[model samples]
Every structure is written in C-alpha cells, then in structure tokens.
Target: MSKASETAPSNLADIDSSAWSELETAAVSQQSGFRYVNLCSVDAEAKPQARMVVLRGADRSSRVLEFHTDTRSPKWLELSANPHVTVLGFCAQTRLQFRLQGMVELHGSGSDLAKAAWVRLPTWSRMTYSGGPPGDERAFEAINESVPSRLADEAEGEAHFGLLIFRVRMLDWFQLRRQDNRRALFTYDETGALAACRWLNP
Candidate 1:
C-alpha cells in the first residue's frame, strides 16, 4: 500500500475542529464552488434513501448548508414531512469526507433566495428547470419533448426552481492517510451553540 494510504484515519474522531474547518474550506473552494454530498432522507415507509447531489453553498459562520433541487422530487415531499437529514461528502484529491446531520427547509419558489439563485444560473442549468416537474411517471411517449423557449431565454417563472437549505446540527470529518486514519466529531446544541468536540481513533 502507498504511504499516504497507510496513514489514513480509521476512526471518526481523530481530527480537530481547526483541521476539519480547513478541510471543509478547501473542499468548497475546489472546482465550481460546489461539492457533491450524499444526501440521506427518510421515506414515507420509514426507509432511508440516499442520493448524490451538488452542494450549492455553506455558511460556516451560521452553520447553514445549502443545495438546490427540484420541488417536485420525492425527496422534497419527504423533507416536508420529516425535516431531519444527513449529508455526506468526500473529496478524492484530499482523501477527506464529511458527514453532516441537520434539519432541512424548502424555500418557496418565489422567495428572494430562490430568485437570486435562479438569476445566477447559467442558460444550460436553466434548461433543466424548464423540464417540468421531476420524477413524474408519465408514459415515455406522453412526455413533452419540446424544449421551452424561456429555458434558453433564461427567464425565471413558476416552473423555474426551488432551493433546499439544511441547518447543520452536527459534522463529522474523516481524513484518510497511509499510516493512520484521523477523524473528528463536532456537535451543535439545540440552540445552535457549539457543543463539545472530540477526536476518535480511525
């Protein structure tokens, strides 16, 4: 095995807050100002569902995590009923991962944040918002194949978009190394205050 791989942390609590924050900052800064996170939510059947999604932004100061998604997706309904969720992210280049647990809130279609986020979207992404409700089970042939002109025009409308905001409650950071693995756990209290932090053997 490689020396770097051999030193990776095996437990989740071996890293410190400062190190964890640094890793998070680096992950957010690399490539497109977005990070892919594995989002986990509870279905109506009480089963856990997980999917990979792009992280739009993170407010470390406020402990807020933000991402965009279609309001018509099942995950949106799932969060509507149960707001608790877990988001996991891994950066291959850094050999680091973040597992965060929090409550989610879906912003309204016409909200200021939604409008601003929509305005910032490029034409290609705006095209996706024009696709209509996501996850609809219509027959393949019955689907609307015509691309809306507004999609290319970059005009925002009722069907344009939605935003998902997650208020992070806890964050676990893991770093992979060749000799030993390092990990750290950070918890925030109900009042949004930082709770105790600790390291664990990875």
Candidate 2:
C-alpha cells in the first residue's frame, strides 16, 4: 500500500498536507513508522536527553502532537524544567524524515488532559504507570523476579499518568531518493498559522 508522503511531493502545500495526514495516522496505527518518535530535551546539567515516546494524538489545525508519559520519569522532569524540545521521526518505507521543534505543555495526574487520556487507556497500558519509577536502578535478580500482576482497578496507575501536548513551531522535512533528494522547512506562528515555507537543497 502506498503511504502518505511516499511519492515525490509536488509543492509546499502537498508536503504540508502529507505530513499532517501521516501524523494523524501514526498517532493511532501501531504499524506506522512514525508511531514512535524520539523526543529530545535538556537535563539540569544542560546535556541533551532523547528517548522514544509513543505518538498518542495529532491535531493538524492546532499543530500539536500528544504523548503520554509517567510523571516520575526523567523526561517528564526535564520537560517540566524546560518546555523547549525537539521531536524527530523517520519512516523508512517513505524515506522521509521529520524534525520538529516545539514547546511542550505538561498536564499532570489531575489535569483534564491527563484524565481524558487516562480514560482511553487500555488496562494493560494503564498498568505501565504502576511500576517502579522509570530509570531507577534495580538488582538483576529483582528485575528477573518481577512478574505481571492482575490489574487492581481503573485508578490503579492514574497517579503517575501525565499528558504531553507539544505545540509545533517549525518542521524540517526531508525526503531521500536515488536522485534529486528534496527538503523543505515550514514555520508556524504562535497561533499555528503558516508563517513561511521554503525549499532547500538536499
């Protein structure tokens, strides 16, 4: 099956449409190449931190992407301290790479965003937040001895649930082919209005 943005884009509008269309699909389809995106943030020491995060939602009109994370995770703390972040994803099938620069708004456990997302999460997915804090060191035996337990209730892991809303400001899109590779940059204003679009030599 042909994928979105799989063909050589004819114009800036085409690239813009294809990018958002694929993002919408990626947010819901596990099979999509963009399903998992690399979110890069800065730590307290000013070092760059990057990790894979699942794409949960996409809004083309608002130019926002949604993700879920455990509030106790290092990424959450990093983002809390500095909202500026870079999101990177590539689809091998389409040979397209998207580098997005944006600011993230974090909604903690009791926020409306977190509550709504929590309601939509499946039992197994919700259980992920119930585990020990992320990035914590554990003994090899302790890890090996861990086993899945029956889910307790709907609210079992709600305490650690967090919602990440990333408002995209710029997108650097590139496509690779045997010849005439192409690249474009799209800038969006604070209101998500298209501020500028330009083609660049790739």
Candidate 3:
C-alpha cells in the first residue's frame, strides 16, 4: 500500500476529530461554505422546507450554528411559527453526511447578534435589505431581487438584516466509504450538554 493509504483512518476509532468537532470546523471553512448545508424548517402547514445556506459560524461547546438572512424572508415566518429545524450537510471530501437537529433563535432589528452581524456586513451585502422584501411578487420585468453589487448605507439594510442562531440538540452522522459505511447518533441534554453517542450498523 502507498504511504498515504497506510496512514489513512480505517474507522471512527481512528478519526482525528470527533464528528461534532469536524462539522464545526467545516462550517467555518471558506472552501466548504457554499457546498456545506441544507437547512430545513417546518412551515405553518407542517411541511418541511429545505434550502441551501452559507455556513457562517459554529460553536462546538454550544452546539450552535449561525448564519445570516433577510428578516422578511419566508424562513423567518416559518421559524417564527416553529423554532425547530434541521441542518443537513454533506462533505464529499470527507465522505460524510451530517443531519443536525436543533431549535433556532432569530435575532432581528435590535438584537445584539443582529446588530453585530450587521456591523460586520460590507455595504454591498447590506444593500440586500434595502430592496423589496423577500418573496414579494414582481411586476413584469421587475428585477434587482438579489443583493446589490454596489455598496448601500448600512442603515438601509438594518431593518431586514437577520442573524439566525441554531442550537443543536442532536447529530446524526453517516459516513460512506468504498468498503464500509458507518453511522452514529448523538443526543444532547436540556442544558446543551452531550448526553449520548451511539454507533449504528449501516
């Protein structure tokens, strides 16, 4: 076998980092951001909706993932009615899929997190909030629905800028390999503490 093959991890027992830790690391990686996540939420009608979102932040200790969004988006309405949600991600490079279940707390307008996130946004990104609210019907030939490429005043975007914080309560992990597949489930207690980690046959 090649030297690299000889040193490769054969299974979870030899993993350099635990599942949660690896996920946290991936969430913050620029290379993984766009291809990283599919966030799921339940709407008022009790249907599940999934969408891709950039992974902006992650905290393993808190089991929390953070992302930015427009406050007026449909997701805000969906989350308002139900704070429960799931974040699904697959990293092809790692051959791993992660399904993270959690409750979300949204920060909008005056919330500290929202304010901080707003300050961090550049003017071009901030301009997205100044446009027509998300999901609004467009007249014939209506355009500029996306974030403006040019810089706009931060104040104009403040009203629509939102910070979404998802606190994970469980993690379901599945790893696909050439010779074998692996799966595991991790549950957390009420206090945001990991309670159990169990492996499953795949």
Q: State which candidate has the highest TM-score.
A: 2
Relative to the true structure, how large is the alpha-carbon lDDT of every model? 0.71, 0.90, 0.76
What TM-score quantifies how close candidate 1 is to the native fold? 0.78
**Tens-digit lDDT track for model 2 on 35-115?**
999999999999999999999999999999999999999999999999999999999888889999999999999998799
> Worst ten-residue run, lDDT, model 2?
1-10
Each candidate's TM vs. the true structure?
0.78, 0.93, 0.83
Q: Local error of candidate 3 at 58, Å? A: 0.3
Over 1-202, each residue of candidate 1 has an lDDT whose tens digit, in order, gives 4454455544433443443454356446646212666899999999999988876676666677777877778888898999999988776655767788999888867898887877776667666665547766667775656655864545544454788888888888777776567677788776655776777677
Which should have the higher lDDT, number 1 or number 3?
A: 3
lDDT of 3: 0.76
State how far residue 189 of model 1 sits from its true place (Å): 3.7
Q: After best superposition, candidate 1 residue 84: deviation in angstroms? A: 0.3
RMSD of 2: 2.2
Query: What is the per-residue lDDT of model 3 for residues 121-182, given as tens digits with 9 covering 90 to 100?
Result: 76767776786788789775567344444545456678888899999898887777666676
